[model samples]
Target: MTARWWQKGVIYQIYPRSFQDMDGDGIGDLKGIARRLDYLAELGIDAIWISPIYPSPMADFGYDVADYRGIDPRFGTLADFDALLAAAHARGMKLLLDFVPNHSSDQHPWFIESRASRTNPKRDWYIWRDAAPGGGPPNNWISDFGGSAWQWDEATGQYYYHAFLKEQPDLNWRNPDLRAAMMDVLRFWLDRGVDGFRIDVLWHMVKAADFPDNPPNPDYRPSMGEMHSLLQLHSTDQPEIHDIAAEMRRLADCYGDRVLIGEIYLPLDRLMHYYGREQAGVHLPFNFQLIEAPWNARGLAQMIAAYEAALPPGGWPNWVLGNHDRPRIAARLGEAQARVATMLLLTLRGTPTLYYGDELGIGHVEIAADRVQDPRELREPGLGLGRDPVRTPMPWDESPNAGFTTGTPWLPLNPDWPMRNVARQAGEPGSPLMLHRRLLALRRTHAALSIGDIRLIDTEGDMLAYERHADGERLLVALNLGHDPQRFVPPRWARGACLLLSTIDDPVAGDGEALMFRPDEGMILAPQDNS
Candidate 1:
């Protein structure tokens, strides 16, 4: 139940390669992130989560890490990363790096030697199996990106498994030696003074012991299918994962104050277990209902209730509206409805994560097939496919390349950059970016907004409302998700509350007729403390 600085802090996720490019090699680098630490500090965020920056071939971007201890030359040297850490700390912000232990790049030396020959000492470091009697994979499992998860290696005359792109091979965590090596990877970064880690695909660390064949899903379809569905019973998300996580918890605890935030998209009830019994597991497991939920009052309210109820008695709750793996919130909720979604994310009873460009209300882009760089898209040409759209560069200015790089960017900038860049929006009072800044500052100023109890208030269609209370302080929040004005009767508790903030262009009296809320509008009201 102890509240650490990170537990109550807002964590901003910056995909460094797409955040900015200092050397103009088109790729975003650590120096670019250093330049933007001020921007993050200005936003009033308490922490920043930088995606993988380790040595890699960019196979799965940086997720297929080639080295666990050093930075890739493409992302700049270890010195550059050290400087970035120093800059972030100087601004009083914590840094959380992404830990991709589920897999490693086949080009990684460990995997190279493991694949070189069966007699290699590190051969058991990766999963390898001989062909069945009929000369095929031992079991059927699908890769998340596309196609079969098993890849035939003629060098070893065996099949190595990958849950994502083939170049990123799944590690054999079943081996103690491999687990120890991965633990060392954690220690290496911890020694570098990283405040924490956002553990990628944490649930997929262990697989079914028997390699059981997963049944086909009855709801299967070709359109934007979950690669997980090809196998009904996931070989991933095994019970053994908890123990692995416990070991990771022990490792993290060795370096005090460092936490492990997990990325597990399971339903709330099941997701709560990742925190482990007796608070011994991951510090926080992400609740991703917003990404996969229907954007409506009923659906969202129900998800909120479920997540709130499922949070462990003393456990912290975390919410994520969107991430690199999904469409931007602006695109999903429509540009006009984006702010309504933002209010819910910021006002909810949790430490919310704002994806890099979401504060600017950036929508998804459409990248042509020939322009696609995602390995998943390249391999599976037509599958409505490609993640390039959401992973575009952040718009920092109106200048060429949107201040992302002097040279062409790794991915094209969103064409709406002229209007959406931070430079233009930073000074605009009505811009979503400024609104986000105000909301974050408000959260920091109000104890009820930061560490408080949540109560979902009943409301009509397209309207979401809730209350956050702590000690004698109480704050009520409501949003109209549509473009047209909507009315709501003030609940008894909110009837006497004073208006604190609103996204509306024109304010309306809280006591007035119907309490109308304009489109994409939200308001925060502080209740009179009668106690």
Candidate 2:
């Protein structure tokens, strides 16, 4: 099988509201992103995945879209978006927009009409059901944000379903008209030259026909969250979702060269189904194993093996370390381990998505109680579910507001921004940002690293090693997850290999037989002949 550009490319995610601000509105805008095209191009990424920029009510931070075809005025005008798209394309970069198909903002005209009366033309556009026998929600469904998933509508005397916030109503995928309208929404963006879409919550698009209550989770724990009390069998990952995914893929196929990336969080076996029986579903199901797996070598090795083993024939893999919703990698893992994590993510056999600000080693910022803006935190406080800490403004330089805005920023910048800003790191050799650039450059130059088949290397004790090979080129990647030095001998076929790259600035010295690796380090080795 041949490979597409997306299959061998690296994607960089940008949260528009925090990336940069050109209008001094305390929020990043499309024009700010446009002005940074050169910076992104120099970062060596092939594509930019911009978080949702559509008109929204700021309820779920743009996830609850009110208008599908228009850009949010806070971000910029439609004309500004067009310019950003053109600028990205001019730099040989692709642009991916976030698409929210599972729900729409309650303020949306479609939802407003749907909830206007029981007999409205769009009454069936959203999921609505009558009260149960006694008088509460229709079923035992729970919202991800918090509380019951059903919101009672006093005017219509019915309850509407919302998998997230009450202000965001779930769309009825069962309705033919609704599906057609949603497909039209995709067309609207594709018509404007959007390279592809990252479909949010793809597995939650459809529910069971009978709307049965979810079974209780046998291993549920209180600290996990309220939604974890149930298995979500009836509310999520229903078999019918595959058909919907395939339908979306078919529509994307019509545009030729456009990709459909589904954001799904499921076990390896179940996640494979999103690839469809004949590879007709989403182009990429978005493998998030790295984000949730244990931060040790053995844990990550097993996860990579399991995921690689679970892919359907002809299905490609993708990976992510952090996103706007999760804690920064530098925060979860220390700075040293985060560097090793970067090597692992890029060296693995898959498309890698880099979160904005991660290249500069940005960690979580402290958000005060009064300054908290995440709806998840507002809904469920004290659970440490707030995402504001990781969504702080990007630090471009050591200036007021970290050069993100002239006015106040929505979220506070990390106190270390003065030394960790991009400008500072860019000027320093062997900085985290420089490491990322070097790794990306290595991938760009080596087919074996970019589109190679990965084979796990058996080893013991605090180390995980793997080999990537393609077109007669081979490379070995080994990581040390321990805090002490460890020795590793290369396989017979890999003997006499020369070091290509190392996470640490020190040279990797070997005693003619085994190589010594410093703590929290990772290295890529290539054959002496190739070197």
Candidate 3:
């Protein structure tokens, strides 16, 4: 099958608020992103998935969007966004905007009008229902942020459903007018030359028609968050969601070459359905298994195998190591093992997404209780589920504030920023940044690594090995996920393979035809004949 640009390219995610601050306002903005376009281009990423920049009340940061088409003043004006788009395209890099379709900020005009009165013209635009007996919420559904999903509105004498914060009300997808209006929102951006959209909370767009109470999760634990207390049977991932996804896909298809990426967090079986019965659904249903899976070779191998096996025919696969919502790879796994994870992510038989600052091995920054900025953390304090640590500002240099801004940043920089900044690591040999650059360079030069077929060679102990082949070229990727040296014996076809890259700088040695991998090291080997 012929590959689309998105299918063969690597995607880098940039949290706009933390990427850079060109005007030194302390918060990164659109102009800031434009200023760093050259840096991203040099990083070898084909596309950048920027988080939401829409007008908002900052309730849930930018995710709680107040205006779908307007740019938030904090991020910059629409003119700034246009310039950034042009700059990215000029560098041959595609830009993807985050599209939040599930809900809108309570301050949104539509939501304000909808809640004005029961007889208002926009009353049906959002999900509203009469209170249950005893004047409580309509159902037992819980908000992902916390508490009941239904929020009581005194003026309307009814409760409006919100899957997240009460300040963000869920839209009624069942309303034909609402669906058309949302589609127009998609068109508004597509017409502006956005290459694609990373649809936010897509599966939550359409919930159960009956609003049934979700079943209790028998395996729930307090540490997993309150949302895990229920199976989410009625709140999300309803079967009808696929039809809605296809509708979004169709609209995106209207504007040729644009991709639709759904943010789904379902199991492999359910997640694959987002591809549609005939692969006509979202182009890429974001795969987040790696983020939740254990950081071990055997566990990752099994998860990868399951994901690979679950994909529909003609469906493309994608991999993600980290994102704005989760802890960084270096934080989840130690710094040494993060290198192995990077090798595994880039060498897999799918498109890979790199989170900003991950290339420099940036781990979670310590967020003191008084300094925490995430609403989730503020809402559910002491749960250790806040995402602010992973959202710290990017360290560009060793200068004050790591050169991210001239003013105080929204969040504190990692203390190691001086040594870990991009400027310091860019030219440093064996640095995490250099390793990422080399991996991306290798992927660009080798079709086998970019669009190849994968075969799991070994998944025993703390070692996981795989072979990637395409167009008569084969590359073996071996990762040692342990603290002790491990031996990897190549298959007969790779007997004379030459080491192309290694996490460690020293030459790889062999013991009786088997290559010895230093602890926590990963290497890529190409057959001598092909090399």
What lDDT tens digits, residue by residue, belong to model 2 across residues 478-526? 9997888889888876777988899998788788888888998899999
lDDT of every predicted structure (CA atoms): 0.85, 0.91, 0.90
**lDDT per residue (tens digit) for residues 1-531 in model 3:** 477888889999999999999887899999889988988888899999999999999998899999999999989999999999998999999999999999999999999999999999899999999988787988999999878999888887999999999999999988999989999999999999999999999889888888888999999999889988998988898877777888888889999999888899887888989999943899999998878887778887888888899899988999999998899999988789999989989999888999999999998788988899898899888888899998999999988999899999999999899899999999798999999889999999998999888998864668888999888999999899898988878787788688999998888899757888899999999988973
TM-score of each: 0.97, 0.98, 0.98
Cα-lDDT of candidate 3: 0.90
The parts of candidate 3 lying over 4 Å away from their true place are none
Candidate ordering by lDDT (highest first): 2, 3, 1
Q: Of models 1 and 2, which has the larger TM-score?
A: 2
Q: What lDDT score goes with residue 278 in model 3?
A: 49
Total backbone collisions for each predicted model: 0, 0, 0
